[model samples]
Target: MSTPGEKPDTRELVEADVVPRSRWRMQLVWLVPIVALLVGGWLATKAVLERGEKITISFKTGEGLEAGKTKLKFKDVDIGVVEAVTLSTDRKHVVAKAEVVRDVANLLVDNTRFWVVRPRISGGTVSGLGTLLSGSYIDVDVGNAVKPRTDFVGLEVPPVFASDIPGREFTLKSAGLGSLDVGSPVFFRRLQVGQIASYQLDPDGKGVTLKVFVNAPYDRFVKGDTRFWHASGVDMAFDTNGLRVETQSIVSIIIGGVAFESPADSIEQVAAAANAQFELYATRADAMKQHDRIVDKYVVNFIDSVRGLTVGAPVDFRGVVIGEVTQIYTRFDPEHRRFSIPVEIQIYPERFTSRYQTGRAGGRISDDPKGIANYLVENGFRFQLRSGNPLTGQLYLAMDYFPDAPKAKIDWSRSPPELPAVPRTLQSLQDSVTRLLTKLNNIPFEAIGNDARTTLRTTNSMLSKLDADVIPRAHDTLASAQTALDSANSALQPESSLQQTTEETLRELARTSAALRTLADYLSQHPEALVRGKSGGQP
Candidate 1:
């Protein structure tokens, strides 16, 4: 600096001659930091935007869901986050805006179901408490395979995986539907395999129809011959023993379910229509269908025929239960203009096949002609009334095979086969007692009382006459004979006639006593004389 300013050295003029050239270097140093800040801001913005995909999901309710703080998980891994929440136009549901990771977008599919996962009230499956720390969001169950993007259906409760896929349009008409709730499991062979999808009243409002969905493997087991029944809660029962209902677990008190059992042999044919309807019956309709052709079209009256029967009551052939009474109801028969009770029953004809003899040795009646002749000649089928609960006088049907009985003349038109009458069990015994009392009541009590009185009077009179007349005379006669015997005994006394003989006998006895005493004295004095006298002479 001093050399360049040599011209100014003469005056040492203010040394502020020229600003340093290093000013530009100092400005460059500050500019580098500003450029770096700008690049960093742009990078951060791009990273945030690239992390996820935008998605909108709608829900009926969002009680357990939260926006901004909620996360969406797939296979337990965080895949997305809830960005915003707003109500729909109708204010019926909450619309949730979510940002899912781009990689997981393909997981959304038509079959994918969305529902709120939270703790259950009763002792069942519970979840979503982890959301308290992480947050609450829809759990995405991306199936094992990749799926197409679509709107997923939402469920009020967690959707269960069924073994069989249920038809969307299929419906089940049941007696009681309001009693059942969603998520109630349907059982096949006592194993849970499906659930109730929804329920509603029929268009006529007479009954309810339940929409049920069965899952994969289980649906395969449901064939055309499968039977369904209400397998939930307490089924009402009223009988001679009074009202009785059976209940299982306490949990069943609040929830109900349905069950099905497949027939051992079923038709392999599938329904022609995509959606097929099946009608369930409490009893076998085969026999009834056959009977319908023969019987006149009279209204069926359940009260007249089977009102007395209860659950588990047997519908039998010859004292054996070929079936059982299942349900009973009263309905109007429009043709007859009268009310009638319809009884529903379930029959297992196969149960009676073995009981009927099928061989030449005396087989039961068979539908086959070749077997029919032998059956007619050898055996016959009949139904008999049997007591199930003796104390309650509950009766059931029993079937029996009789080979020795005559063949019954059956009327194909309007004729029910006569049932065999069974001997009294405890229930019949009570009935017998009742009948006996009724018979006794028919007797004329006044006439019986008069006859009894007359008979008693005659007996008393006969006894009195015997005591007063014949008995007294016989006693008098016996007294007279006894007096005569006493007199005869007194006259035959021995003392009067034998007195002299007695005196002579006493004298002899005294002399003999004296001689014996004298002999005893002599022997004591002369023992040697007593011994020699035995050979010599008589003393």
Candidate 2:
């Protein structure tokens, strides 16, 4: 230090004033920490403000949930991660906690649906199979509602993507639940364009209600008169037309399905509104039966027994079913003084027309029963019970023109027009058989048996008498006659003496006759003398 001070001695002597040169430096050191603190605060604030919103979803199962591993995807684009997996309070479901990026926050809504994506095979569809190897994941479907939401109830099954698709919802009512299931295809003219969304049984247990979805282009096929039928499984039928096997599709055959068709004229009509209620027919035959309309109600009284008749039996015209029996009852007729079975039937005039009476869809027959009855009776129209199923003894009402049958009188003064009936052909045959059986029962079987027994005994006695004496006596008589004939032949031979004597006796008889004739002539001359002994030696 002393050596360096030679130059510094003068410099230090000048600065020896000890001017307290600001013990604090340029203050940049303090500024450094302040800037760092401010920057840290700003970074912290940014982190806090930019954080994504947290969401909770309830799922029936946590099958695909993995803490920090399960990613939520929208259309295969990852948008969130499952942060926590826990059970609901009731333990009926799993609650998955997730953080969704702010970028997609608008997608959350009240109606938004979520489901686990895994390998599935249903209704001829194989979905999410790639997830088998990649592992399962949560799939998110955004809703269109403007209201934002964070809590969600997950779906047990994947929902149809209605946002990207245009379609409609419709309701179907059915009397029975057939092969149709959720995801079962709905067909339009054999083209699959929809599916069954849900089903519910009526509270009364009389029918099943189904909710179905139809895609855009195919939904236009549904109309006011459209017919929906269960096309699932195989349809086998044998009829006058012959055996028929009907199926909508191979998928339908495997998984079950529904099909719909509109009337030809309805093709140009307006499409049914969303959630339009329609009937689901059990079979195509039932759908085509067009049983919706009612035109006439009539009472047909049968003269013969209605043993095989039942409600819902077809009332046919010729071979075509035009109506059905609705009710059967019997009430004593105060005027006619008899209790008769009243078969109440409903007839559809549209059934007789070549095409359905869609123009008359809401129309009904005139209420003038007297006029209608008179017209029908004048036209020789009659109702009769006919055997529909011979093996089952099922009978149905048949309306036909029986020109030669006795005229049927209709009593139109009654509440429901009464239609007189002719005996069924089968009933007539049964009556004939009954009469024959009655006659057979009345036959004198005991008297016939007694007579037959007496005849048999007499015949047996005669046979015994013949065997004991008649045959032997007859044989002896025949032998004696043969012996006498042999003796006569021997006596009358050409060279025998009896033959020569017979010739001489014949000549003597001729001579005696001649002498008797001459004596009779002489006796006639002397009347009294020849009264006795006219011929010689005659007296």
Best by lDDT: 2
Deviating ranges (above 4 Å) for candidate 2: 1-39, 89-92, 202-205, 237-244, 265-268, 301-312, 327-343, 350-367, 378-380, 387-395, 403-408, 411-418, 436-539
Query: What residue pairs are clashing in model 2?
Result: none
lDDT of 1: 0.58
Alpha-carbon deviation at 468 in model 2, angstroms = 24
Error of 2 at 496 (Å): 39
TM-scores of the candidates in the order shown: 0.52, 0.70
RMSD to the hidden true structure, all candidates: 15.1, 12.2
Candidate whose TM-score is highest: 2
Question: Per model, how many backbone clashes are there?
Answer: 22, 0
Model 2, global lDDT? 0.83
Q: How far off is model 1, as Cα RMSD?
A: 15.1
